[model samples]
Target: MKKSAAYWIWTICLAPLIFLAVVWQKLPGRVPMHYNINGEADRYGSKNELLVLIGILFAVNIGTYLLLSNIHRIDPKKKYTAENLPVMKRFAFIITFFMTALSCFIIHTTLHAGSGFNGKFVVALIGLMIAALGNYMYNIKPNYFAGFRLPWTLESEENWKYTHRLAGRIWFVGGLVLTVLAFFLSEKAGFNVLMIITAIIVVVPTVYSYRFYKQNLNK
Candidate 1:
């Protein structure tokens, strides 16, 4: 593994260990998140088992990063930077971090330990992370494989360029704010903020870009 990737891999491994170790014993036996979209509860083990599973997720994340890094190394010509992916690979790790925490929350509730959960609130947290992920993906590439992939964006390179230029800044800043808030806001209020922010990010650029492209096309 390249030194950079190796460092991140190790960093991921230790992230949960350091953050949750102190509170590992304090984790509620059952964490009840009201919204069960998939109806899948992560209630399959003792607290000890749950901690092990978290470790496994951490390990898997590092391994995946390693593999991708190797791919980059093999094809040194291939660069995974903001221009190519708009900082997507880097943002992906952040998304994964939030997702892991969300999953742990689910497990914490399902195990039926202590503390009542605010379902809407927890759902909002997940939504914020998801919105951030979507924003990053859109910024990463104008290609269909990455971002919003609107008809205009896909149809015209110019449109793609313009849309991403605007989208990148919007999403990056929006995501940063949301991520920070994720640390501070209560579940319900936090999610409400995330939902509103997500809608604005999606709707504004899409409408603006389409109109902008049309005007240019006519001109």
Candidate 2:
């Protein structure tokens, strides 16, 4: 059978569920359901809760795919173009894959109770995700659902392009730096650095967008 985007989406989404089913019998009756900033398990729940969590993940992945696949129907201002569909599909795939990986990590950690799921690792993963997104940020067409949808960017197509291009670079570089720091710095110190980088990536684009808008308005 020819593979398609939907086929990949479903396959990626279902892999975790299948893994969970295979390992369900091996899991303890009570498992770590949540963790703290210090990479310690702070909450516990019945193993059955994993089933619930998996169900939710499946729903979110499928729901998000369906919603994005039909985003043009919901957004009144913009219709899906041939150019945007592949970008959107790729975005959806990235999100689903990330979620699947996260869920599997959670399950693995829960199974091995003492094995700490490093908070810094999650930070690093998020950093990598942001960096991956940056690669496509410039290609994202103006839409209500994604990208840096600030008032100024939404109001002006030029503002959107300029801001996204700038934001993409910032996020890509900042994310790599954050990922490196996550490995070297103490968890507390790494978390602080991550926040600072996050602020820079977000605030810089927002300020630039406003300025871009104003400059255009005055012209």
- Which residue pairs in candidate 2 collide? none
Q: Tell me the lDDT of model 1 at 160.
A: 74
TM-score of each: 0.57, 0.92
Give residue 207's error in model 1 in angstroms.
Answer: 0.9
Query: Whose lDDT is greatest here?
Result: 2
Q: Tens-digit lDDT track for model 1 on 44-138?
A: 34566666666777777666554433343343324333364325455656655664665556455544444445454455465566556655554
Q: Could you tell me how far off, in angstroms, the CA of residue 59 lies in candidate 1 after the best superposition?
A: 10
The Cα local distance difference test for each model comes to: 0.60, 0.82
**Native-vs-model 1 lDDT?**
0.60
Worst 10 residues of 1 by lDDT: 30-39
